[model samples]
Target: MAIRGYHAHLYFDPHEVGHARAVAEAAQAAFGCPVGHFHTAPVGPHPRGSVQLSLRPEQFAQFAAWASEGREGLTVFAHGLSGDDLADHTQYVIWFGTSEPLDLSIFG
Candidate 1:
């Protein structure tokens, strides 16, 4: 079954901090949703500096479109919150650039 919510991880390198912020801000501005705090380094199991946005299913398609086109050179890790963490991060993900290895232990 499809999940009712989604989480998008916006990854950036330290040098690209400003670009990362721009993307997150644009997402908040466009979607009118709360974006997570920006991290300059990997927080938890993330492999790079990142920010996150959580959106309802209603907002997923719109956000996905903007994310897919607006990330510039940054990478995005998007997945559903369908209760199965492993499948959610792997099978159910959409990538805007190269996929990064996540600390999946956090999910289980």
Candidate 2:
């Protein structure tokens, strides 16, 4: 390992709270790391909307189907996200694990 390490952050706009929250909960239970934060708010002047799974600057790639900044490994922690079917708000997924993540531009 190098003297320094890197991490990533991701924002997702799910359409369902239960779905999104499930993903977050699953991640927390699976990973030894903390879940960081989770919350909900309104969008476009409407009421009763929620966007879950907000990652800190430090849980993004664990659920990324693709890679961004790390070497390919058989130890991938993806392919296990749950309840992730919400709408268009913004939930940042911050990953601080040892695996490097793919760049954000790829998502664009």
Candidate 3:
């Protein structure tokens, strides 16, 4: 299935919230993608506090590269939005740092 878009979740702890906001703001400024709320608590299947960046398919490569170098010490969980939540979170995912275990049971 063709990916409709992408979601990159920047995971952070309370101590790193400011850094995460800076990273997210910088990405929004640079890439013109919409940045979601700075979630201090886990939302959906995310395992930690996270900020979500929504990107178009055309923006994926550049954003991914930029994020790789710009994420500081945060773990980035990126996945393609392909309709099927399970496949999107599993098969179509990419990680920019140490991967974290997502609560995939939320998808079921």
Candidate 4:
């Protein structure tokens, strides 16, 4: 099934912090993906975290571009979460791709 969009919790290194935020604001431009939700951290070790985001339908091509020219980052696995998990600060990206029926409840 072709994915309609994507929901993710993209993380970043200190240098990629501001640039990662820029990805949300300029999704179409930066990643050829649409941006949504975009809830930022209030106060904590995750001061640079953004747990809400939605990418566009053209994920393959967009990801291709990213793979070719994007910077490097880390990804946290399913068991790498801490505390609320939603706001865990792992200094890396903790996002997943979705197909058709996206269940935001899983993350909440």
**Highest TM-score scorer:** 3
Clashing pairs in 3: none
Q: What is the lDDT of residue 47 in candidate 4?
A: 32
Q: How accurate is candidate 2 locally (lDDT)?
A: 0.33
Give the Cα RMSD of candidate 1: 1.6
Q: Give a tens-digit lDDT track for model 3, residues 39-105.
A: 8988899999999999999999999889878888789999999999999999999999999889999
The number of clashing residue pairs in each candidate reads 0, 20, 0, 1
The C-alpha stretches of model 4 lying farther than 4 A from their native spots are 12-17, 42-48, 64-108
Q: Residue 96, candidate 1: how far off, in angstroms?
A: 0.9
Model 1 per-residue lDDT tens digits across residues 9-87 = 8998899889988888888889886789889898876899989889888998998889778887789998898898788
lDDT of 1 at 74: 89
- The lDDT ranking, best first, is 3, 1, 4, 2
Model 2 regions lying over 4 Å from their true place: 1-15, 42-108
Please provide TM-scores, in order, for all candidate models, with all chains considered together: 0.87, 0.30, 0.97, 0.38
List candidate 3 stretches off by more than 4 Å: none
Better by TM-score, candidate 4 or 3:
3
Residue 88's lDDT in candidate 4 = 31
Q: What is the C-alpha lDDT of each candidate?
A: 0.86, 0.33, 0.93, 0.40
Error of 1 at 102 (Å): 1.9
User: How does model 4 score by TM-score?
Assistant: 0.38
- lDDT by residue for model 4 over 1-108, one digit each (tens)? 233444444544455556666554554566555544433442222234344444544564455355333423432111122334443322222333221222234454
